[model samples]
Target: METELLSYAFSGLLVIVFFISIALAFRFSDGHVRLRKRLKSRLIYGLPVGSMITIVTVLAVYLFLQGGIHDWDNPVVHPFRSWSYFYPTGTVASGFAHGSPSHLTSNLTTTLILAPIAEYIWGHYPDGQGGTNASRDQPWYRYPIIRACVLFPGAAFVIAVLTGAFSLGSVIGFSGVVFAFGGFAVVYYPIITVVGLLVVGVVRTILDGLVEPISFAGVTSTLPGWTSTAVQGHGLGFLIGVLLGITLLYHRNKRPRIFELFVALLIYGLTRGLWQIYRPLGGNEFVLYRALGVSVVLIGAVLVTATVVASKRPLFEGSSVTQREAGVISLVAILAFLIGPGIVTNLVIIDYHDEPADDELAVEDYIIGYDENAENPTEFVFDAPGTDETIERTSSGVYVASDQRQLWIMDTSQNQLRSTGTADIQIGGIGWRETVTAERDGLQVLGAQSVYAVELRHDDQLVTAYESNASTANIRIDNRSISFAPDIDDRFTITVEGSDGVEETASIPSVNESVEIGGIMFRASETNGTKFISAERDGTVTTVAQEE
Candidate 1:
């Protein structure tokens, strides 16, 4: 519920900002852009105008490929569903393909607003009140083409690898590329760019945190909603842009004072360290590491600001930089930044003695047949295949069955079936019903049709510890604790197994009733038929619309 409120608040903030930007844009457009107007029209508008044109062209091609604009009959032709673009093809298709009209428009809007601003800065817009003449003949790397060449490939590659590695579903949009524009703007126009990107980042982070995720094949994919696509990709894209900006600072000057070099190194390290704390792949966050990461970034930002402000006696002070040298440095820096995380991830996985297939292998395979292939082998697995029957098994050889109107448990040891009443509704439509199953050695939990069941594995015997009906809108399992709220009720329940292995339930009043769970006190209420859940945790009160 808190998540929903944050979404509304962020949306409201964007609407307000949208109007403010319009007013500011017109106010600033009082015809004083000699430098901007002087640049080649293509250099000034290529990214903004070209990107929009490409989006529309791709949409037209997509319609032709699928026989209609709304034709989803052949999802293989859809960029987001196609495996071809998940890798090398990423360079060609990722930027042009968008999921919907709104998706395309959002990217177009941001690109139009931020890209032109960045292009002007790259064109060396004379700010009049400058210490050093940024108007000094710009290098080739500073040209729009070179910057796009570097930014597009770098951003696309990063997004592709990240989604391929961590995400089960595919994503295709220009959000990541739009973020790169914001990134370039930050170093070139710190005040405006930083503030703008920060607001966007915060809003996106809040939305990502609020959504419920579906666990499938040992991977958690967020259920499609208002703000789930490419959430982490935005973070990565923005990070890449910032890294490029920092590289440019060093490229401008080779010789520097000891203190200046120290500051530069500090900024670089802190930028990396900050990502370490909240990187795409989850990292263990020891308190000390997190604190130091944040502290370094803050200090680095201050030093960077100071250095930029004192441009005459800059930290990386050198006579001049050649175009080729700057380009090489930029390429190396971007590649290294993208590669470092992969190296660390591999090392960490190896150190922890973890294998990629451990989780899936642990889940018992109820295979009925197998298809052999030299390149990629396939195993045909069996389950109760029907709209109403879905079966899952545990590593300990117990099967839990969820069907319409009743829940069934079958013991492999005795080959017996136990049935219990369930609130499994006969709902129609794709989003109407959902199911998620998770398992451990002695535990298997199935959530479906607004009901959840827990099966305890005991010597090939399945023991039903708890079975109940609740809302499927929000169901979560952490170790032995299960948390959920019923769609029809005003309270949520937390069922935790005690030391004796017996299940106990605790019901906390919903947001309207003002109750506390896990130290978060909230009130559940209805306003004009819309249910809202407000939760207070760590002295912050967050209210959100309850999703049913």
Candidate 2:
């Protein structure tokens, strides 16, 4: 606790130092005159009301609605993810909800740094930008407070809902909106946006290092880092933001340099892993198309650059439509093409609502089970014609499925549990949350298969969910074979079978102990950190089982 407090203090001090350095640099720099002028004018008019509201609302949703106040680390996350179009709660909340405190903090931090910049570009007082205004006419809706408090926030909310509704699958985070803020700021202040991205990274690194000053870790199995990213939602948000930024810039009769916009978009896309275009081959397998992704991002950057920097003159000598108008139409068409697939995918209803399997545990709307390799229902939920044969999805390990939420995901894989021996699965909704712990206990025989059992514990109830087949060692001792099997009470039992129909079974003895069964004495012994079982009968000794 003392270490943690000191770490927090140090982290806070670093943040303060960073901001002070930035302030000093800006104060002395000649290039910051425009920024100073903007700030001076904006400060007297109003604050970044829309940005503050968004940050507060996102934090409130994560803390209160997702039950993060009590358990900040392990909040109710499954129910808040955008699962299906039919589930209104998930569809709406997923945009604001976060999977973990780290996720929430990172997104809020990005927003804190970039949102104000975007809002600054979109000034509190409209001056023929974003919307039309009559000359010297002050409309009631054109008030600074109205633009800052009402219009901006309202636009943000609508965008959030749209992002959540059109996201490819169950995604939970504020990152989509964060990307939107980045996209908006990049149009007017491309260099500043990139610098802000770097600052956000540095801040996250500092916080992480402070939280964990020293660490100990071992090798563990995990999927590719990009597999979990909600690329579709992020792309949609960024495109929308760019569109809005360009529209505002056009209305205000201003345009950024073409090269600057292209470079900024390209750099941001590459750094943010937007170039990771992947498809889940299921069973913890995924395939990423690096070349295709890079090409797509490059083309997208070129198109956006063209759209923003196009001349107002007509596209051709005979045509009335200007190049800028044609560019805007092309962008709108692209956005529609991007959104149409998601809408079709989301419209499909879940069909696998059968009763839970015998070995599966049922808790309210959730069904938990352990399986080596089972057909993943969520992958097939959207039965796109001819795609089933191409995308065969399978899952292995402890999984939780819910028909209502249209969720079927492997929480922990079989290999992970075998190495770690334990996992906790969090499941719940709205006002409540619960954790189901899965434990793997077993003994592996040398040169043979392992005998094991998978058990789950929730509240006071303990269930042995799965038991593997008994395995016997290949070696024999005095015409008797030794076999190991997992018993009901979460322990291994040893069985000795003789050639003349004589057999005996007994619980495996503890270390440095011996048990006699059917005239064969089985002794569990350890030497030089190696554990092995040996049998002695009629002055004959032979090795039987050993830890693998």
RMSD of each: 17.5, 3.9
Best model per lDDT: 2
Off by over 4 Å in 2: 1-37, 43-46, 128-140, 216-221, 352-358, 379-382, 385-392, 500-503, 525-548
Clashes of each: 8, 0
Q: Of the candidates shown, which would achieve the greatest TM-score relative to the real structure? A: 2
> What's the TM-score of each model vs. the native?
0.36, 0.87
Tens digit per residue, CA lDDT, model 2, 87-200: 788888888999888888878888888888888888765662333333457776666667677777777778888888887766788787888888888887888888988988
Residue range with the least summed lDDT across 10 consecutive positions in model 1: 367-376
lDDT to native, each model: 0.39, 0.79
Error of 2 at 320 (Å): 4.7
lDDT string, candidate 1, 74-109, tens digits:
221222221222123422444445555445555655
